[model samples]
Target: MRLSQFFLPTLKENPAEAQIASHRLMLRAGMIRQQSAGIYTWLPLGLRVLRKVEAIVREEQNRAGVVELLMPTIQSADLWRESGRYDDYGKEMLRITDRHERELLYGPTNEEMLTDIVRTFVKSYKQLPLNLYHIQWKFRDEVRPRFGVMRGREFLMKDAYSFDLDEASARVSYNKQFLAYLRTYARLGLKAIPMKADTGPIGGDLSHEFIILAETGESQVFCDKDWLDLDVLDKAPKSAEELQSFVDWATGFYAATEEKHDPNAVPIPADRLHSARGIEVGHIFYFGEKYSKPMNATITLADGSTTPMHMGSYGVGVSRLLGAIIEASHDEAGIIWPEAVAPYHVGIITMKAGDAASDAKAQEIYAALTAKGIDVLYDDRDERAGVKFADLDLIGLPWQIIIGPRGLEKGVVEVKNRRTGQRDELSVTDALARVGA
Candidate 1:
């Protein structure tokens, strides 16, 4: 992508309404523009990052044996009524009415709808351990939607629904998602600790919320200090027993959101407890028959007896992760994107756009990187060198090649690592070889 032709409307100053680092940087970097309170339009650069996040979520979901499908944003009110939650869901549910006066709603979640679909088609235990998932947009009309996409009214989410014949089987599905979440966050360059959490409106007997530590988080978190050092992914548990053992080890540590915490309940000594603010990026629930019982979603057992299906729901805030990643990764200058989710892998900065040598060298480097299947952002704009450097740094690509007349005279170019702020002067061939571009 050429900066000169790209629709990246980066600003020199931050927007007045942005109150946090992620929000401010997103605005100044021209990644997104607010359309309304708690709502925004993701520009091209922002969409690239959002899509990358979605891809990771999808890959992990698939690895966990969750089948992907698309679900509609608007749902029939009858489904919610059958689940006995139409009125109970409260004001956050955006209720609507069609021209014919039939009630409708923009679904905040898909519990009732999934249950309805299962009840209509699934009839026997043979279809027992099915998991269906989708990546879609959701809306919850927050009373005060603030903090950019963190607390947005409209957002993208990856939601998975699991159906089992009984509670024991449902837990296996839950464990699968548990490991999947751990793997997902690890791939995205985050150490997400699974914390005991209140299920809230989801109404589940067992629930866990994945928390990523950040100073500018929305809620206070208390956890066993040991959690920071444990990598559940490293354990690589595959069998049911192994998976359960890993989950047990992870949850055995004392950890809870403020709402679920009790001072006397924690077994950890004060010296071992770590208290910090954290962002909730994903959540999972084993709601059993919360939706199935109310909606009569049932299946026949092996003995021919009929029973409501046991169900679990898992979710990752797809769009909200953009804010969470920025919160956990950015520095004073701009967002230092983790390599796994960076918008572009390599950047070619033309030090003097009008200079023939500099421009030609940048083009060569850009072509070399792109031909190697690396996403390269070419800064070919007719702008000052300082301005281009600042913009490139602000967007925070992982690798950069600085092509200038002076460096070309030395038979070398400058290569910089964005994260470490280290620069090396090397021959153009050496630089290309270092990056394998």
Candidate 2:
């Protein structure tokens, strides 16, 4: 994409509303614009990153054997009533009334709706162990929505509902999601630790919150230092017993949110302990019959007896991750996007857009990169070299190719690594191979 043609309205100065690095960089980089308190319109650059994050979530969910389905953002208030939670959900639930005076709501979560759907169609044990997932927008009217998309009232989410005939079978499904989340975060260049968590308002005994440690995070968390090195994917479990073994190992360490933390109950030595502020990026829960039983989502057992299906809920903060990632990855310069989720793999900055030789060389490299299936954002606008460089750093593409009259005269271009801030001059072919590779 050419910058001249692209609608990136990057700001030279930080906006007053931005309180943190992610918020400020997002605004200055022209990735998003706030329309209201805690609400934003993702611009071209931001939307690309958002879609990439959603795609990774979808891929991991599918890899874990979860089927994908779309659910409406607006749900029936009567659906919540079925589970006796409509009024209990409090002011955060955006209640509404249609012209017919029927109660409806912009769903904060989808447990009630999903359970209702399962009860309507799934009838027997043979249909057990089904997992349905969707990537969609959600809203929760926060009383004090702040910190940009980090705590937005409206955002995108990836939610998956799992149904199984019994507690044992349900665990197998839960374990699949556990491992899936590990792979998902790792792919996005985050080390999200799974810590035992309470099922606030959701009502489940078994739950885990995936947290990424960041100085700007809202929640204070305590965990073992070993978690930084431990990869959950390395300990993937295939059966319920194996799953329990892995869970036992994870819980053996000291890790909990403030609500669940016990200062003196930590099992690890003082040296091996660690504490930090963390952002909650994902959560998994096994709420045996919590939604299903209340909603009468029953299935016939092998012996012909009827019982409520055991269920679990898995959620990834699709939109919040953008903020969380920026919080964890950015430097003083700007966002240092992970390679997997970068809007473009490479950015081509032409030092002199009007110079015939420099312009031709940049266009040639851009074409070659695009032809090689690489996404390149070419700054073909007639802007100062310093301005282009700053924008390139702010947007944080993994690699950048700098084309100038001097470099073109030498039969080469300058290649720079955004994260390392390293520059090397190489022939156009060598530069393309290095960045495109």
In candidate 2, stretches whose alpha carbon ends up further than 4 angstroms from where it belongs are 237-244, 258-260
Runs of candidate 1 exceeding 4 Å displacement: 259-265, 269-271
Per-model CA lDDT versus the true structure = 0.90, 0.89
Candidate 1 has an lDDT of 0.90
Clashing pairs in model 2?
A: none
For every candidate in turn, the CA RMSD to the true structure comes to 1.4, 1.6
User: Which of the numbered candidates is closest to the native, going by highest lDDT?
Assistant: 1
User: What does candidate 1's lDDT look like per residue over 1-437, in tens digits?
Assistant: 88788898999987889899899988888889999998899999999999999999999999989999999999999999988889999999999999999999999999999888889999999987999999999999999998899999999999999999889989989989999999999999998989877789888899999999999998999998888987667786857679888888778888887887888877999988899999999999999998999899999988989999999999999999999999998888788998889899888887886999898889888888888888889999888889988988888788889999999999999999888999999998899887666
The positional error of residue 146 in candidate 2, measured at the CA in angstroms, is: 0.5
| Local accuracy of candidate 2 as per-residue lDDT tens digits, 1-437 | 98889998988898898999999999999999999989999999999999999999999999888999999998998889889999899999999899999989999999999998889999999987899999999999999999999999999999999999888888878877888888999999999888888889888899998999999888788889998878766776766567767867766767888777888887778898788999999999999988888789999988989999999999998999999999998888889999999989999988875998888888888888888899999998888999999998998999999988888778889999999999999998789888865
Clashing pairs in 1: none
* lDDT minimum window of 10 residues, candidate 1: 231-240
